[model samples]
Target: MESPRVEMISNSFVKPKFISKEAKKPVYLSPWDLAMMSTHYIQKGLLYALPKNQDFSITAFLDDLKDSLSATLTHFHPLAARLSTVKQQNPPSFSVFIDPNNSPGARFIHSSVNLTVADILTPTDVPLVVQSFFDHHKAISHEGHELSLLSVQVTELVDGIFIGCSVNHMVADGSSFWHFFNSWSEVFRSNTISRPPVIKRWVPPGSDPIITLPFTREDQFIERPSPSCLRVRNFHFSSDSLVKLKAKANSECNTTKISTLQSLTALVWRCMTRARRLLPDQETSCRMAADNRKRLSPPLPETYFGTSLHSVKATATTGQLLDQSVGWAAWRLHQAVVNHDDKVIREFVNSWLKRPFVYTMSRYFDASCVHIGGSPRFDMYGNKFRLGKGLAVLSGYANKFDGKVTVYPGREGGGSIDLEICMLSKNMEAFESDMEFMSVVNEEDNKLRIF
Candidate 1:
């Protein structure tokens, strides 16, 4: 398929209406944020269809959006700040401190695309289709210049508008990211902000040497090698199929019932491992991000922002993963989830204090790995920016580097799920034809239920 044609109309920065009084003071990055400093920026995009007879003016629409963004930034002022390091200390330390004198505003781009809404909605190559809507480069260099923690691109099409946003991972996780987006949408639609985020940084009590010192290290920023032949394909599973899978998983063991996530993840892991054609004893694993907001003692507020997440991995030999039933893999995943409690969170903090450096999970990004991200709980479909019902499509631009798997609520809503899987182009071809992998998918031709 040919790349979608896009033309940049304008580029500008949107500053806050008025910097908050508290933003004048410098705030340190939390331990969680420090740990995630080396990762790539998080990006999300949404495509909204415009009514056929709707009167549209690009200039007026952009003006309204910029105005609302400025108002929204008053509450989320930190996003307008830049990352700076303290040079007075023995080793320079980095923090997201605002210099009231010169704050780097968020980047906003207005562009025009030749494609229509139907072109995006129709079935096509997942990676190319999604990447065409993204305005900025995938990677961000945080070392040299002032960092704009948040950037937005609004692309206008004949039948729709594509809104793309990029946020530095150090500023927020999935939950926090959505909180900002929802708040912006609320402000744009109703001229009012939602619940303001809790900006207080949470630090464990103790003056231990490790706890006080910064975790930044030059080696921690080493970039991972990008896969040479990566490709993305999307698969959908209906709510009924998930229920059947959960029931089948539960039938394997009487000790505990497996959840839909666990069953689905296990199925994906098995399929990916088989498609890769790894050795029998090759190590294979599935890694998922677990939210630690409620798991912490003195649970973080619902509005608390920043990265309050931890990774959990379920592992087995490729032979075992392939030879075992889906129930067996689900049980393993279920156990991994059970293991991440309050104690585990505390232990993770303590461990980070000791090591104090950012690093990728080597096993989780390996060829045999299947990394799961995003969650069914997020309200992806409800993000209406005063426009009509907007459909959110899973973008593959961010996860195209490795064996990444992103999960989102299906377009039909209800409890159904859509999984966007990324892998080597050759393996994807084999995976698409795998009978076991195809069994659970909701296909257009096969209408009969397998169970």
Candidate 2:
């Protein structure tokens, strides 16, 4: 062991410096983080529930998770590690910095996690512990930054377990989150870091000149709301069954416009419509997140660790929505993809310079106004790679959040999609029927798992 005299000398003379060569500088978040920024209260408290298998263990799971996150954390360059501070909360919020260390860019934030659900074996009260964790995390703030991204909570319930992660809105986006999760898992499975996450020059070229303003100059920063109610639900599916559903949707639409994702979106939209009994004339928006990394001139690297694309808001009337078959809805959904549109791209750029957070338009579609969520993602690559679950959440300002569903191909010549819907207890039945229909359509052809 080192002597206390030497330790004191080292402490007096040596200042710890962040080894960014091996680690990333903290990335800060800006008010203009996402393409479709929801108002604060509209998109904050999201929960996802996943069914637990008897074999899953909380201790082993957390150990693996910590190992994976800690390993991948080293890949970020100093600039990427820059954290952001926004002073609009009870405790100022902390965001992952989004601007390139050397260049001007919009600040975006999205975070990720790997969680497991195991049966509660001990008689201890888990919710109490969970509440404590929440309070502790909530109170923990990043030093000098207005946003904090390190809040994590774990709770053991009588039936299963829960993991809660609070992410600032200005650091990364959904696609970035996916890339991060995959990288974390890759390192965990291999027991070593994989290739560094790709972060090519993502900003498109030749924009009209505009002055760079501090975040305070922006019009709409997401305002934090008073504490509110939050809920979670979990679901799963096999890989093969989803393809069949997509095929059926394609046939019904009589066009190749239907993708597995679009078909599932149609199913989700229909169920949400039926459950809410929304009128056809009522304006409803199902904002589908489109990744724009490849749409730029110098396509952003898939592993680039910041918000890259603007969210495309697809608005449809309840009547027009209900009148369409799964195929038609899928086509409408496809037409909504506008990553290549120059006008939209310009707006995205301008959003960063203007106020009221350009992405805040999504607030108009909050739970009270429109349904502002989308279906899960399930691709063949997700399965062969064992990328854990492809769950997504749509939350920001409010106490409520939406779930993520993924489609996978099954071994028995079918495709399946797993859905985890979290809403009020009153809406549980509607959610079940939606899942049931999706399962029936896909499972009829093969095996399906709904967890």
Candidate 3:
């Protein structure tokens, strides 16, 4: 079966004509902010060889992108027009354009690299190549007021050339990015854009007769990051394991209150703690973000952009989590999730930025990291995205985007959730092993007996 490299773009199957309509609200990012955030989400340029059709021109394709972005710029927040900055020695921070006058939102760059098909598939230096790329990007910390996002490069050995391009996240989310990409592909294939993007900004907290802002004094906090013992890793499970997990999750709660995500997360916690032999004494928690689109009261309009979700945490003393049956832990997770709502998320953001100095206190905060549970969101289009070179965990939790790691599938069936765990290089194997074992425990009904 082929993955959905190119597919129809719309809410349904129908092609859209006329400039797409977007909600008119002032909630979207300023050009500058968009530039910085884009660094975090933009996938490095993908290298693929389409049939050498006569219509394909990398140069023309770029010109079309520039035109698309130029037309869309006026719709973004003015602040989005600014660039991100970083200190000279910091890990690659998200990029910021140095020329403030250069107009907000830069067009993506395209370049090419030369490599043999065999070299890309089995080059002994691939891991080193990947690791070095990540390391170069890590130096992007901001000092004083400097900012920088990574510039991507692709080396196509077969073509014996390279392609370089950059995308800003503020202008688009994963969904929007792919939307833009697919549109670009359509242009390439047909030399005609069947549909131009609909640019809309949905601002929450709609203007009321009485003055009301979405957040109060207690709504936001900025703190320096603290140290953490929490481990993060991603691993893949067999399709059978997921099926078994869902079935077990359903049966565990008697259909009263349980979800597949909740069940698997609780199960993972128990298995990992057991392997470390710390299940008996440690207090561990599982944190996941719930999409607030359908969960919020009055539900925010689909057009409303910006942060729309908050973290939900489930916990158990090491003993309770490890000793209790898996269903019980899942129930705890379900309960915590049930208790969550928009108000709680609001309070969290408000509280985080409460004190004027709180935002500057990132030097003091600790033990507050969130570990997201996986969900179908990772399936970008129902097809699993095969990881290409220079890729990091595409959507792990960060202080960005609802301040939690997101674990949705890149596209539906893009491939099952890559429970791939990322960590400092030294810990990668250990985290991978833990995920592998955890996946098995969730799969076999009798496996728990061994513990």
What are the models' TM-scores?
0.91, 0.62, 0.59
Off by over 4 Å in 1: 88-101, 127-129, 141-145, 207-220, 361-364, 445-451
- lDDT tens readout by residue for model 1, 1-451: 6756778889888888977678676556666777665566777877887655457666788899999999988887777777665543556554333344476588898888777765665553453655655644555425313657787888888778888887877678888888898888888888897699887666676733223445355554545435577877668898999888888888886645689999999989998889889999989989888888887878899788777888799999999999989999999989998888888888878787666666454523566778898888877777777666676554625535557888887767789998878788888888888898798998752222111
Instruction: List the RMSD of every prediction in angstroms.
Output: 3.5, 10.3, 10.6
Off by over 4 Å in 3: 1-80, 83-104, 111-128, 131-136, 139-234, 275-279, 349-370, 373-375, 378-415, 424-431, 434-451
lDDT of each: 0.74, 0.43, 0.39
Instruction: Specify the poorest-scoring 10-residue window by lDDT in model 3.
Output: 6-15
Candidate 3 per-residue lDDT over residues 81-109, each given as its tens digit:
33333223333222222223333233233
Q: Can you give the lDDT of residue 244 in candidate 3?
A: 72
What C-alpha lDDT does candidate 1 achieve relative to the native structure?
0.74
Identify the candidate with maximal TM-score. 1
Ranked candidates, highest lDDT first: 1, 2, 3
Best by lDDT: 1
